[model samples]
Target: MSLEQGIVFSVLGITLAMFVWNRLRFDVVAMLALLAVAVAGLVPTEELFAGFGHPAVITVAAVLVISQGLVNGGVVDNIARLLGRIGHRPTLQVLTLTSVVALCSGFINNVGALALLMPVAIWMSREAGRSPSLLLMPLAFGSLLGGTMTLIGTPPNIIIASYRESGTFGLFDFAPVGVAITLAGIAFITLAGWRLTPRREENSADSKLFSVGEYVTELRIPADSPHAGSTLHSLLTTSGDEPDVVVLALIRGEQRLAAPSTYKVLREGDVLLVEADTTSLQTFLDTTGLELAHQAIDDQEAESEGASNNDGLADESRGRNGFRETNGHNDAVGAGDDKAASDPIAKGELHLVEAVIAPESSLVGQTANRLQLRENHQINIVAVARLGHRLKRRLGDIRFNAGDILLVQGFEDSLGGALAELGCLPLAERGLRLGSPRNTALASGIFLASIAVIVTGLLSAPVALVAAAVAMVLVKLLSAAEAYKAIDWSVIVLLAAMIPVGQAMESTGGAGLIAAQMLVLGENLSVASVLVMILVGTTLLSNVVNNAAAAIVVAPIALSLAGELQIASDAVLMAVAVGASCAFMTPIGHQSNALVMEPGGYQFGDYWRLGLPLTVIVTVVAVPVIMLVWT
Candidate 1:
């Protein structure tokens, strides 16, 4: 090989190694590779950032925004609710959910489709008393498999389409090979993949939906409390009695009573250490005229005039339980504006999120009080669940430890940044939108119209999808801020940075050199064998790096190899497209796999149990489909 080809190959090797190691972000590795190629004078420095503006990158970003629009406009909600009504039989549920997820993924961005369905999968697993592993791995694999069906379904398809010179592969070009492969893969996963999943203990902590009564809290008795003189036994029998509410201990005059007397009378200065879910705690306080000690003074001050005359929410039979002006004891936060007017989260700015602390979390040893989380991060720790035990401490005083799951509330825009700073990973996402029927119709209409425009050749795919995204913002289906957040910047960076490096490989004849080597190795093999080898190699590369990067790197070589074989390049390129989209063997292979890992309670090795067979099936099915359709 010449000097330029040797340098390009060396950079490609390093890049692929880093991707597999996964110590650095793929975007970071891509940029380093781009810089190395540019510094070597293989690509011009001025054109290094051209990939950011590439049509494929734009289309990927637009597709993501549009997917978010569908989510925020309640399109996914309607679908999920419809599918949720299906019975909870594990095999049937897996088939239905995975089929739906895969079908949606074929039209929308696969990761976006996975995000929309993950909560439903978790709920299904929880309701069925099954490990999330049974559902999540299949669902993730389904989304990946499904993405092969359409050009806009995944980034690899978009990248490969952009690389085609004849513009022969339009939006639906991938449908022939992709559909057959998706069907076979989905069938395998639905019928057998779930059974191969590891079965583990069913822990409520693993559920993304935080159940009520999982948090421990300390509530203080006030001077005017009617329960001040009531015995603990009588309180339990009272009309406001909640079975889940248990007094773990009592604190009075600096003494903690771990086993307080059942007949013990409550006092104004006494603090009751309680173990109750969030909902029960709210009801307990409202009915008994008790208040949180830390917020007692604030509660009094915030209590409006005639609030005492009103007898608080305890006496009133309001439909909503947790909408108190102060303390907010048991109010459940909804993902959309469906909440009652009294609900604080009904305001568009507020959101409730569950986040788990990572092992190396910065907040590991700090208490909320010390961090002044409310003041500094504008986040409130509503409750905490640690090791299946509810912590019976004041919300502010509970010290954070690794693996503690915290339910925190803050302004919607700041949650992502704040969670990152706290070294926490968000659990299952909740409350995607207001769920208005009108918004759903409008969003779906806009999306379909954009696709129609592309199919009709009125606009390019990137422009059409971009217009659709802009239309979503214009119609308020997604706010400008939300649209920006919907686009994954890291993915954008990786695609943009790697595009130039891919071009450098092609310009330097590195791809041709590699293709020549492969051709010589496969000289004695049949075309079918060569196709299988190409599919397997591309699938392995995609499993390690960003699939879009995989496509960009392999597409040229696939085309070159096909030329050397004196056969039609379409089938080989189709192989590259299909192979690049099926990264099911590892969690790091695709974002959808990574998205389901924590919630699924999955280990690194768990994926291949189902994924390996699924990959083999795709290869066995896709090669013939591509050869038949393209040749």
Candidate 2:
């Protein structure tokens, strides 16, 4: 190999290692590789950052924005509502759910499709009396399958289309092969693939998937309590042996302060909403002399002469260890009281809901305390459930991860907006702003018109999609901020940085060297066998790194191999596209996979039970289809 080729290979090797290690984000690793190539003189300095403005990057961003617009316009919500009417037979439910999600995936961002529909799947599973595990993986996999059907469905497809020298692939260019594979894959999943999924139990109280019950309760401070006048910080830190409880909110008279300052002074008659287990609740009650709100109300009724006429706060039952029980619903404290009208909690405006962190959420790696969630968003995280693992840390001390299910408490009016800003997907269904017929019509019309433009060659894929995104904003389907926030910058950066690296591989003849070696290994093998090898190799690479990165790195080599074999370049490139989108073997493979992990309670090893066979099916089906059509 020449010096430049050696440098390119070494840089790529290290980049792949870093991607696999996953210690750093893939975007950071991609940027490092790009710089390495630039310093090695493989990529010109003037062209170093030009990938940021590439058509593929623009198309990916535009698609994400458009996906968000569809979401805001309630386009998917209408479809999600239809799933409730599907009969409860497991086979029928799986088929309907997967088919709908897959179809949606063809046009919208697959991850976005999964996020919007995941709660619906869990709801369907619960209603059908089945484990969520049975449906969630299939749903995630179906989204992946659906993405392979269209150019704008997934970032990998967009990246692959950008590799065509003639121009990007038309809107429905991938339909032939993609539709075949998606139908086959969905059929397999609905028939027998879902049976392979592990049946993990779900917390079924009040239709909630997580156990967020007595862990969060309200305690009232009595006038004689020794800790009544102490600051919250002082009370918690009084002794190292104090129970590991977090005060989520402080209620004084009609005022509710969520995530109150640690230094705020506690007053007699103040109610504290805290998160603690039974043992900690008892310990805190004993050591601090704080009484459960129900107990305190009973005591006040007993002491007053005419208390029988007052509202029956004493009627509220207490759970074990004197904690105020919410039964299954996380109803607010002081509910049903006219005196507390100023407080959202007392007015029944406060709602407790569960949300899952999205893979690209800004809240990942952040602590509730650090994000100032209660202060900034007027919301507090009462409890967290991660991959079926019980969290032992205090609520504020726990760091958030993608797929962590959080039980959040906030006013119903602002809760949805807060979760959206935080990049969380609510597990509970809520009213959609654009669920109205007019808005839905507008969003659908704009999207279809853009597809028409691309189909008729009126505009290129990126330009048409970008125009659609702008029209959506102009029509007020989604606001400017929401449109900007919808773009997954990590994927964008990874693509921008890796595009040039892929070019450098070809520019330095590194891709040629690798393709030559691949040819030698497959010299005795037929062209079909070589195609399978390329497809399978790309599939494996995608399982470890970002799918877009996998495509960018592999497309050049696939093209070179096709040239060497004197076969159609489109056929080889199509193989790479299919393989890159087939990252079903591991949760790390795709955002859709990881997004469902905790919700489904899937172990790392559980994915391959279905993913392995599905991947084999994709490889088996994709090769012949590509050969027959593209060749």
Tens-digit lDDT track of model 1 for 1-631: 8999999999999999998887777889999999899889999867878898999889989998999898878887788878768878888999998899988998887877776777677767777777777888899888998898888999888888877767747889999998999889878887787898877567553444354333545567788877788887677557643244655456675444542555788888787655465676677776676776545433564685423322222212222222222222243321111333344332334555676675445687788757867557766666687654556565556778755778776656777678856767665544333469899899999999999999999998888999999999999998898888778778899899998999989999999988999988988888888889888999998888889889999999988888899767878888999889999888778878876766666777988888889889999999888778887
The TM-score of candidate 1 is 0.74
Best by TM-score: 2
lDDT of 2 by residue, 551-615 (tens): 99999999888888887888888899999998999999999999889888898899999999999
| Candidate 2 accuracy as TM-score | 0.92
Candidate 2: which pairs clash?
none
Runs off by more than 4 Å, candidate 2: 203-209, 224-243, 254-265, 286-289, 296-329, 335-348, 429-434
- Per-prediction TM-score: 0.74, 0.92
